[model samples]
Target chain A: MIDQTALASAAALLGESWTPWLVVPPGLLLGLIFGAIPGLSVPIAMAVFLPVTVHLDFLSAVLFLTSIFTGGGFGAAIPAVLMNVPGSSSAVATTFDGHPMARQGRHSEALGLALAASCAGSALGYVILLLVVGWVADAVLLLGPLEMFAIAAWGLTLIAVLHEGSFIKALLAGLLGVMIGMIGMSARGDMRGTFDSLALVDGIPVVPALIGLFAASEMFRLMRRDYIVEDKELRRPAFSRILAGVGMALRHPLVVARGGLIGIGVGAIPGVGAAVANLLSYAETKRRAKDPSVFGKGEPRGVIASESANSSSEGGSIATLLALGIPGGSATAVMLGAFAMHNVTGGPRFISENLDLVYAIILGNFVQVVVLAVLGLGFLFFAASLVRVPLRYLIPGVLLLALLGCFSITGDMMGPITMVVFAGLGYWLREHGFPVAAVVIGLLLGPAAESELLRSMQVSGGDPAFLLQRPVATAVLLLLVASLFYPLLRRRRRA
Target chain B: MQGQRGSEVALLLLIAGFAIWLAQDAARRSFSFENLVLMVPVAGLILLLCGILAVAALRRAPQEAGGGLARVLGLLALLGGLVAGLETIGFDAAAFLFLLAATALLGERRPLVLLAYAGIMTFVIIMTLGFMLPYEMPTLLLDPPR
Candidate 1:
């Protein structure tokens, strides 16, 4: 599997005068800062900087973009650790334990564990990608529209049933999310639920909706308190404690490895990337843990599970993009554009012709992990202080920033309106014991699932037996059934 | 506790009603196995889930009174107003008013300090989002004369 000439070419590129010493570091920082802020995501950063990459050589441009990709995988966990807010959907599960840890005065430790797990996971993802890209390329082709739809449905069902709420409420929330996600024009050019508004043509802007659902809603809940953490002693962050947290993360090798595997598997699937990967990994980790009740109340393993999965998902997304020329998510979509800009096609032909470049991209990501660790340490020193900011000031500041960020997303009043509307809805739903995570996941996966289902029906001419032809889709449906009942079985066993 | 149950029921009904409306719309658009664009099955599933939830809510025993309902609703009202006013009065002015109201509600007593904080915040947001980035926010105060 190892191509020696390609390895040498990768090494030669790394040895270039400007590649390692200057370009990659700044890209990582930009990605970190952009990703750490609510409303700004890795994809947004990549899109913003895509024009700038036009000036550089193909290798340099890819190196820069990949660094951002690597840095963003961890940077998104920052807000999730300190505040209850997840900067992006991928970090939603991270907030379950990361924020609780912050409340327990272990914010530094949570950040440290997240950082270490992210680094490990990213490296593992790349390793898997490098080794199995060729093999997986063939398997991906077998996964037709029905298989894809089944996979999404399975993920959403698992997430919904795993919520703390009543199973009915959870399922309702998820279904509602799917319905809401189908707000725009359908794949067949038929409008479903846009209410005849031009702005609704593009569907609800998800990042803004995410910001409102998590950040704004959480901030409203936190407003009554003086600070994120009440204890003055716990507010002070020490480098030693951070190191100890890193040690703690290192101790949980099994959790980290499991999370990385899950990340790679789910992330490899188009449209279902880090966002669902982190949620599924966290749910699995909690289900398997001896003290599952402690999960939402500040468990280091929870942070490790989510961070590792979300980070590793980056590598998985990259694999699909490279081997098949199919972008897994928005970030890879931007990368596909970058590929076009550089006149580098990314299918089988590109892999055969530029195997060296493929190796180079993977190698650059491995190097990015080490550099991310160093920069991330400096970032933590400043980030841990955020808990000390009074809630009165912090609430308005974050809301304002979120509003501005949302505005930037749609470039209109729709952004602010979406934030306001979703914020209210999220608070109410959360208060009523509806799992907001399930809803968000449903929204994210709905369009893809709907499109796939429609395509499958079209392909089969509406024959129900068409599903029998696809073994992968059948297997996925079986897994979905098993996952739904597993929780009930476990509860019965415990009883 | 009773109030919470009532609110939950109301939410469930709202969802069920919306699902019914969606199904009706799909029927108008030619709901069938052939019309792949008709997401009627999803709407039907939502209705079924809502029905299950409503039944569950009725059977489950309610407990514990919550106090922050008013606070949440108040904040939401302010947020709604802020969003509605953004395009009309502009983001800066609307955001400034929102900040002032939100801070005051959160118990910031000092009047001058509130004014300064809201003003500075609005200015920074406009500058950062409108001027620095390519984000196009409506701004009566900052826009060049037509």
Candidate 2:
């Protein structure tokens, strides 16, 4: 599978140019800034910077863009650790343990673990892509609607795994999120709960709704506290502590490896990317642990699982974009635009013809990972200072930023309006001991689940027997069933 | 404890009620297979969960203390006001006023600190966001010279 000639050419091409290396730092910085903000995302940063790539060679352009992808993957975890605000949907699971750690005055360690896990995951993803880029298209082609629905069902099992207080309440919250996610128009041109509003036609915006549910609601809860870290002695950011955290992540090689594999697999699918990948990885990691109760309460392994999967998902997404000419998600979609700018099309033909370029792209990401580690340390050092700010000022300040960010998302009042409404719901849910994270997972997976199920139904003409024809889908569904009952079986055995 | 329990019950009912309303609306539209494939089953599950939760709430007494209701409500109102003010006064002025009010409500009594923090922070945020986003944000005081 390895192309020796192409590999040599790729090395020569990279070594020939000092220009591509220079763009890496600025691109990474741009992604970090965009990804660290609550409303903005990696795709947004790439979209904003796409025009600039026109001034450079194709190799330089892609390197710059991929560097942004690398940086943004880790950057999104920053706010999730410090403020219980996932900067993007992909970082939601990171907050499950990350924010709790922050509250416990271990914010620096959480940030460090996220950073190290992210770099390792990105490297692992690219290494896999480097080996399998030639065959990824054929593999991706086998996933039909039935299989996709099965995968989504597996993702939804996260709700059960994330249960904390009341299992009934968690189910209620998750189901409610599913209902909310289905509020817009159906696939068959039928409007369900639009309430005659034009904005509701597309559905509730996910980013703002999540920001409201997690960040704004958490801010309301933090009103009684003076600072994020209650202990004055633990509020300061220490470089040594961050290094310890990095060493800590390295100790758990199996968790990082499993998360990376899951990320790459899920991210390769179209319409599903890091958002589902992180949750599924976290669920699987928690499920397999000897004592699953340690999760979601400042567990470093939870942070590692979430961060690794989400970061590796970028490479998984890039695999689809490169091998099939299909944009895996919005970020890869923007990258397709960059490809067009340079008159380069992505597909089997592109891969076969420009194997050298493909190798160069994958190899460049490996280097980007190293640069990311160096830059991420500096970034974490500065971001870790957020715990020092008093909640009195930090609360309002972050809220204003979120409000403005939401406003920028929709260019109207709708974004902020949705955020405020969900903020109320989130606050009540949190106050009443419901798992807000379960609701978030439900919201993220609901539409995908519904649409995929509808597609499966249409394909099978409502016949349940069609499931037997697709062994993969049947196996996945069975796995989902097993996962659902495993916890109960484990508890029963322990008792 | 009673208040907490009451709030919990109300939330469950609210969710159950919303699910019913959505299902009814969908059925009213056409009850097509595509429209109800996911909704009907999900709505059924939500109602069942709501019943279970209401029972659970009644069985167990609330143990968590509640003292920050007023501050939380005040913050919520301030946020609501900021959203409302965004359209009337534009982002720049409205955001500035929100920071001022929010800090005051949160117990920042020093006038100079509040003014400086709100002014500088809002200006920096608005300016930074304005430069980064492509959309034309509505701003009263900070509108760029076009």
Candidate 3:
């Protein structure tokens, strides 16, 4: 079952001393710090380290990447539990429960619990990743262009519908992102909208666009603050605190399992990635909680569900990336390039031939859990202190990081240019209270929806009922329509 | 800002403008139309209507002036430092300088303290990212002696 060649290679590159014990905690801890920091996001951290992945063996490289991801996922809980700002999009769910707990001076408990659930979720994801790739992939292969389109449309509509404030505003932001997305060499024959800059030819790199929206805007907004990161309570978070965290997670296994399943399902979908997965998972936790009313002001259960599901989703997402040449998310897309650099071709046939390598990847993740558990504790302790860093000091530093992060993406000024422009746009929108998440979601779903529409056009020969003619596409479109419109309808009735 | 209630009222006009822009451009380039793009102005018009409705709601509420000129200018200068510093001095040189200088501008004043924090942080970042990870920074600028 194992590729002895890859297995021996993994053991060697992971280093004789770099057992799962050493590898897991630090990797988890590093990711948590990245996640806990207000503006330092998982994707930014991933891109910064992407070049390094090229230098390592395939499983070892993915192990490192996933380690950063795991750390970052739990890291968001720190800020949410402390400062009320979610470190990453996925952590938005964490804030529902984590923040209130912090307000109640249970920051330690909230952070610890989120960490435990996150690790549990990651462990479960590894199990699924190891077992499901060979058995269930054939079932999923039936997803056609129409199904993909419907799903993508459903995703876009869901994003637009679910955003805070005006539904119209959310859709507007999405429309703008789609316009920005259209700026590069689209699959269509027309040069589209690149206005002749060679930089625009390949389309905008998702990392830079994301950096501009999330990282740069965050930095700019924080630039004038004089944040004083308050130190942790001198009493070190006790082992008892961690034990309570474990109890809380297991007690609500239902919450943890549901979140993990969301992560896995979202991971399996093409185009939709962890960001969307975590968001939908959080929304579901909010929708179905025993105390749905307790959500949003800080609910520990909300944090646990979101944190666990988001981290768990990673293994499944990567499984899709490894087993199908198809990408499940942005991180996986980047990993694909990394895979090429390492001379590893990941696809169904590749996985079948290199099952050991696949197992090694899963095995490496299991090793990550110990690291994740230990570092999760470390990050939990530091989370409070990180929030105390004065916004003023943090903002300028982040802006600089954002710009630098952009340049590091491709080693060019264009990255910074994109960052500057998008950030300025962000500032303009921020003044109006527009949600940037809406824009990111729209941009992500745009090309897929557009391409699918193109397919429908070709198949229908321009029939007016083109989308409705196909059952799968119609079902998806209907789901999308319902997802987007339901909230508005509900709100209207409430008013 | 008039809450741009008129702007909201005129949202239909704005959508019409965008519709013309997209449709005319698509025609000029002979690109296939998605009709989904048509959703843009329609949505915009809806937003305009909503924006108009919100104007009354917003007026009753007060707005905070977010920041001042000094801060805005400072942010612009810091953004420039990102462009100029990395290219001029390199990642370590530029990063070290940018963090130090920008933090000072952002309000941190103690020289030795700022430099100490900046230097150690820069070194750690460079070693971790550049040496350990091999990320490509502006090496053309920083490849000089450490």
Error of 3 at A26 (Å): 5.6
Candidate 1, residues B112-131, lDDT tens digits: the string is: 99999998888866766664
Best by TM-score: 2
Model 3, range A1-495, lDDT digits (tens) per residue?
Answer: 335676676556445545434335555656766676554566666766777767666666778787877677677767656655566556655655676676555666777788788888888877766667675366457566677777766666545334566655666667666655655555565555556668778777655676567656555665544442233452245556756766787788887888788788776776665666666766666555444556656566777777888788777777787778666765677777778778777788987787666777777776777677875665565554544566655665556555655665656778787777777666555556566766676666677777776776676777867666567667656756665556567667768
Docking class of 1: medium
Strongest candidate by lDDT: 2
Give the alpha carbon lDDT tens digit for every residue of A1-495 in model 2: 889999999999999968889999988888888889888778888987898999999989999998888889889999999999999889999999999999999999999999999999889998999999999998999899999989988998888888976677788888888999988888777888988778998889988999999989999988888999999999999999999899999999999999999999999999899999899989999998888999989999999999999999999989999999999988899999999999999999999999999999999998999999999999999999989989889999999988887887787889999899989999999998888888888888898888888888889998999999999899889989998888789888989
Off by over 4 Å in 1: A18-20, A463-465, A482-495, B34-65, B140-146
Using lDDT, rank the candidates from best to worst. 2, 1, 3
Tens-place lDDT per residue, model 1, A322-431, is: 88899999899999999999888888777878888898888888888989988888888788888888788778778878877787777787888899888988888888
DockQ per candidate: 0.55, 0.84, 0.32
DockQ, candidate 1, comes to 0.55
List of clashing residue pairs for candidate 1: none
State what share of the real interface contacts each candidate retains: 0.59, 0.91, 0.27
In order of appearance, the predictions have TM-scores of 0.92, 0.97, 0.77
Chain B fold agreement for model 2, TM-score: 0.91
